[model samples]
Each structure stands twice: as structure tokens, then as C-alpha cells.
Target: MAVAAAVIRCRRLNIPRAFVISMMINAIQAAIGRSMDPLLTPPAGNSLHIKASSVDGVQIYTCSGGEWRFLSASASLVDSSNSSIFIGTYAYVYSPKHVSAIGTWSLNNSEGVIAESGHAASEVTGRVIAFRGNKFALPAFLAQASSHLFDGTASLVSYIQQIPSDGGVPPGSSSCRKGSRQVHIPFEADYWFWTQDRQPPSVPSELSAIGLMIEGFFGTGHVKYVFNGTSWQQKNITASMYDVPGGILVGRFFIESHADDAGGSFTWEVFNPNGWTVTAKSASPGVQVDGSSLPWRLFSVTSASFNESFLGPITQVQMISTRGGLPPTPMQAQAVVETWKIMLLQWSFKVCMKISDSECTIT
Candidate 1:
């Protein structure tokens, strides 16, 4: 037969190759057309080409039959039963329009919600609030004024200075300006002294009848007197005089040599108004009045020469000669005798005196 019987070459059937080819084709088809539930789905043939979404939550993709079904639950939107929701301690649940019903609420000790004015009538405002001790009012009048604000160190110093110190008088008080006036006694006279006297002189002699002023100032007493001579001298007297109140007179004197006569001398004595004696004797270069161990008194001798003179309250006088025991001289050493005297005078005066009208008997 002319049929192409001859071309029937017997080729060995490649079953293993065919099987491998069929398996590859099946895997490709599974990857392209297979669909599965996410929970029960198997791995895709190719690496999954999953497009990532920007949304944050639990997302699931399922391939069922031949189409992709995406399932997602957004944490922000989903109301999951087992979801962790943190409710602050201070959170209040009230209708949005009914803000007046909201009150201070605290959860645990941490979070709280408080009213704006801390009053029941005020609306609840603060979120994530805390109860710090007690609530206080918003200072309306500023506990103080802005003008009272201290801005600098100088202002603060002035404010502190204005504060009254302890034991101090406040401003505008009468005692604030009250002060004690201090009166000081003048001790200019070199013969100034004072004492307490208990007796008076027996007679008006050179050793007595001398009164000293006893003035009291600032709770203390003082006596003062003047010495005519410029130099201090020793006196021969060691007894005290009992005279005026608070007067104790001791003999004290200053001596000087005769200016006109060589080897001649003069002595001065100051006697207390009470019985007290003071005698100045002649010595080389000058007369020395031994006033050692003398009591306190005040006296003044205006003149050293023994003479009959009356000056201000001075009434009596005495004279004594010191030239008796001197050595012989070429000329007749006539003993020069001098007299000394003292006067008493009132030194204080008062200008006015007030008598009660009821006590006054006017004639």
C-alpha cells in the first residue's frame, strides 16, 4: 500500500518526563486559581505577593476558590470584647451636652477629673487631673494687688525694712519719737569732789564754814568747785567735813611760792562748810599742800593773801605766818604773814512755781 506505513517509527513513550511536566503544570495552576480560607489555607505555590496596608490592627487575607478576601479589624475602630482599654481614673461618663452633671471623679489614686472652679455648680473641665490635698479657689482679688508686687532686690529690701522690729514702737505712735535727754555734769574745775555729810561745823573758823553745792543729775550726785591757782599742791589736812546732804569734805589745797620775794612762800587752804581743815605750807620752788587721805569736798579760794575782804558770801577770815622757822638771812627776815578767807553763796535759782487753785488762799 502506498500509505505512509513506513513512517511509523516506534518511539519509546517518556512517562517520567510527562509526569514531571504534568506536576509542574498542576503546581502553576494551584498558585493561580486556588482559593482557601485563611484559617485552613495552605501555602501558595509562589511567595505570597501580599500588599501591606497602612492601617494598624489585626489583618487577615483569605484566598477562597479563586478570589482574595481581606479581613481586618482596626484597633481604633473595633469594639473587641477581650481588647485592653485603659480607662483613666479621672474619666467621667456623661452626655456631651450634659457637661453640668459631670463632677470630680478619681480612679485609684492616679487619675482624676475635677471641676474648673472647684465648686459643685462649676462645670467639670480638667482631664487626667489629680487631687493634691484640697482644692483652693482661684484667687479673685489676687491676695494682693499688682502694685504690691516686688520686682527687684531693692524693693524686697525696702519691704523688709518697713517691718517693725521686736521691742520697737510702730510708726505714728507717741512712744516712737520719745527719748531721754542726757544732762552731763561739767567737771572742769580741778577741785571737783562730792561726799555724803552727816554733821556741820561747830564754829565759823578757817577749818569750817565752807559749804559745797551738791547737785543731783541722772540719779547721781556731784559737787564741783574752782581752785584759783593753776598748779596742784599738797595740803596738811586729813579729816572729812559733815555738811550739806550727800557732802563729805576733805581738806585739799594748791600752793605757790611768793613771786616777789626770794625764798618766801604763800599757802592756801580750803575748809569744808562742815568741820574739815586744809593747810598749805611753804616749800622749795613752791608751797606744797599735803592733801593725801583727804575726804571728798568742793571748795574755792579766790585769793591766797590773808586780807580783810568780803566777796560774795564770804564773812570770816584768818591769817597764819609760815616764815618763823626759816634760816637766818643777811637782811632782817621779817616773817610775812598772809590771811585766807572763804565766802558762802547760793548758786541755784528757780524762775516759776505752780500752786493748785484749790490750795491757793489769795487775799
Candidate 2:
């Protein structure tokens, strides 16, 4: 009985030992299996939680933010986030739906400077350049055509027009003639005439010539000529008469005296070069010019005038007219005047001059 008891004790001991041995063998096999097939086991806990789609080759575990380690000893760690991870290059994570790959990867190494499929040949070859602030640098060859050669404020149209090409004389100088035989002559020292028929004949009766003569008479004024096909039209005549302050002159003169009496009254519209509009009209029939009636005589001098506080600072002026009646006879009418005249008063204020056929001094 004693021997049997001892044998039973030994048997029990052997059973435990054998069980322990079996457990040891199974643990070794499990470890080997995990090493051989990395995908079968779940990644270790307390490790990085990498998205399955963000990596390939092996699973990566991160103990903390920005800290990563591989689960399989054989697999290596690769950064796969879309961030600059290498020198002068960036990383991008990618995973195909069909594959069971996981972990971080170095996108720069496999993908190169540009992606294989999405980028053009030039971009893949590193020809493309990028700049800060989301800017882009064009290739040198492309820059030759795309770059601006002129300053931002340069105007091609204005530059071309100003390139010494003839713009023709101002609209008003179209009718102006140079010599005494012509109806109009520009006011210049060379144009001053001693007689009506001579080379330097008397000033033409046209407004342009009259303006020049008036400038000579005032000793300090300028004359501009505009041609209306038949005669030179004078505009913006500024005459500084003797012994007058604030004496700036502004007026227009019509070459055709008969225009006013044609029942087609002339309307003179004045405008400063700055585009301010002002108007002056010829005295109408039954209207008073220096206290007289219109149609008194065709070519009769009549001055209808106006005044404004803002006429000062005026550097240039323009005039236009429209007529609407049959021409009048000389005896039946007086010399017609179709302009506004402003003269400085003794007090240095502007005073309008309203002259009639008899009031004006023709000589």
C-alpha cells in the first residue's frame, strides 16, 4: 500500500509537469506564428492607433503623438502623413481598398517629387516650382511670354497716338488759310499785314485773325485758330485791355455776319476745357441789345451776355452755334453779333457787355 501511494504521488507530479511542458511549447508556437504572419494578430494595445488605410507593408503603433514604432520586428516605420517629413520633400499616406496593409510610409521615397499618375511629365521631372503664400514660380521659358514688359500704368493706346503721328489741327483750325488771299490767317508776327492785298495783308475778317489782332492790340493775349471749312473760327479770345484789373477777356466771334439775321438765330454755347457748360445766344428779334430791337439790320452787331462767379481759373474755352432762319438783307438789318462779352468793372468785378448794331465800334 505504501508503494502504491508513492507511485500515485509521482504520477500526479508527472501530470503537472507534462501540462507545463505542453503550455510552453504552445506559447513558443504562438510567438513564432505571430512573427511569420504579422497580419493575423491585432496590434499591441497602448500602441499607436494608425488608420488601416494610411500605411502599407506593416502596422505602426504610436505610444504618443509624433512617436511611432513598428509592431512586427521585421517591418520598418515610415512616415505617411501629408506633411513635410524629409529634406525638401513631403509625405503622403495612401492605401488601396483591396489590400490589407497598414502603418506609416515615406511618400517622398516612393512617389518622388510629383505623383506618378496625376502629374504631367514636366511636373514629375521637377520642372515645376512652388512659392510661399501659395504662389507659383513659372518656368524661365514660360516667363518670357507670360511676364509683363511694361509698367502697370503704361497705356498702349495713348502711347501709340502720341508717337509723333499727325493728329491734324484742332477741329476749329480746319478752315484756316495761311496767306492774305485766304479768308482767314493765323495770328502771328509774320501774318500781320500792312495792306489788304499785300503778302502781310490786313488781318482777315475771320474770328481767328480778329483774335490775333485783338491780342496784338492788348499787348498781352493769345489767339487760337479753328477752321470751319469756309473760314478760320476764333475761340476763347482773352484780351487784357489797358487800365483794367480782373480784366480777363472771354468771348467768341462768328465769321458769317449774315447768319444771325437769317431768322435762323445763332446760339453760341461756351464750355471751359474742364467740361463746364455755359451758353450765350445772339439777340433775338424784339429783344434789346444796348436797348434796341433785333432784325434792325443783317450783320448788325448784337451782344447777348452773361456772367458767373466761377469763370475764374479758366485756361481754355470752346464755342458752338446753331442757326434756324432765312438770311436777312443788309439795309433791313444791322451787323449781327452772336457772342457773350465779359469785361472787368472798375471795382475789379466781371461786367457783361451788351452791345447793339449801333453800339459796337466796327473800326
Please list the Cα RMSD from the true structure of every candidate, rounded to 1 decimal place: 58.9, 48.2
Model 1: how far residue 267 lies from native, Å: 3.3
Ten-residue region with minimum lDDT total, candidate 1: 137-146
Candidates in order, TM-scores: namely 0.12, 0.13
- Candidate 2 C-alpha lDDT tens digits along 190-268: 0000000001111111211111111100112333334343343444333232111111223323233343433323322
| lDDT tens digits, residue span 124-240, model 1 | 122111111111211010000001111211111100000111111111222123242222111110000111111111211222212221111000111222223332222322111
Off by over 4 Å in 1: 1-195, 198-252, 258-266, 269-363
lDDT of each: 0.21, 0.20
Can you give the lDDT of residue 58 in candidate 1? 26
Model 2, position 296: C-alpha lDDT score: 17
